[model samples]
Target: MLAFKVTTVGASSGFILTKEAMAKLNVKKGDTVFLTDAPGGGFRLTPYNPDFERQMALAEDVMRADRDILRALAK
Candidate 1:
């Protein structure tokens, strides 16, 4: 596991990502990252939006349920 240290950001505390961590996460300065709840315990840091994934899953379900209507509209 990678380790990070908490530092002061003005009056707030934050962690600085190392170059290796940044590259591994495929993120650059000003890019947004999410800290989400993980299974069992702790948190997960990811570049992907979990809400978007859920929305896409719902969209896919609707598309599958309306496949015939979609196919007709595509023509």
Candidate 2:
């Protein structure tokens, strides 16, 4: 399910990402893609970001869990 067409770049229109969708969205050229907006409305390109958020959430959880240790270190 890959279909991109859009054209017209000078005026602000893109979507050329071929090459097997930039190698499964690994990105290369400019590197940085994140449409995001899935769920029911549909729309999710993503070259990361979401993952960063998830990682940040996990980090926060760990920090919270070890708050006591951190406080002790601070003092």
Candidate 3:
């Protein structure tokens, strides 16, 4: 496990993640990461938001189905 020390970023405090940790998270600068409190008490960090991804996939299917209507609406 990687431990990060909380440091000051302007008025707010934050942790600086190392390059290796970022690589494991599959993220780069400005990328969004989700931090959730674990069941036991710890926390979890992840790059993927399953709900958002599923929503986007469903939206894509709808867009494909309604492409002609959407095209006319854009005018």
Per-model TM values vs. the true structure: 0.84, 0.48, 0.63
The prediction achieving the highest lDDT against the true structure is: 1
User: In candidate 3, what residue range of length 10 has the lowest lDDT sum?
Assistant: 42-51
lDDT against true structure, model 3: 0.92
For model 2, state the Cα shift of residue 64 in Å: 0.9
> Which whole-number lDDT from 0 to 100 does residue 74 have in model 3?
100
1-75, model 1: which lDDT tens digit per residue?
A: 789999999999999999999999999999999999999998999999999999999999999999999999999
For candidate 2, lDDT tens digit of each residue in 1-75? Answer: 789888899979887988998999889898888888899998889788887889999999999999999899999
**Using alpha carbons, what is the TM-score of model 3?**
0.63
Quantify how close model 2 is to the true structure by its C-alpha RMSD in Å.
Answer: 10.1
Number of clashing pairs per prediction, in order: 0, 0, 0
The candidate scoring highest on TM-score is 1
Query: What is every candidate's alpha-carbon RMSD to the true fold?
Result: 1.5, 10.1, 4.2
The TM-score-based order of candidates, best leading, equals 1, 3, 2
| TM-score, cand. 1 vs. native | 0.84
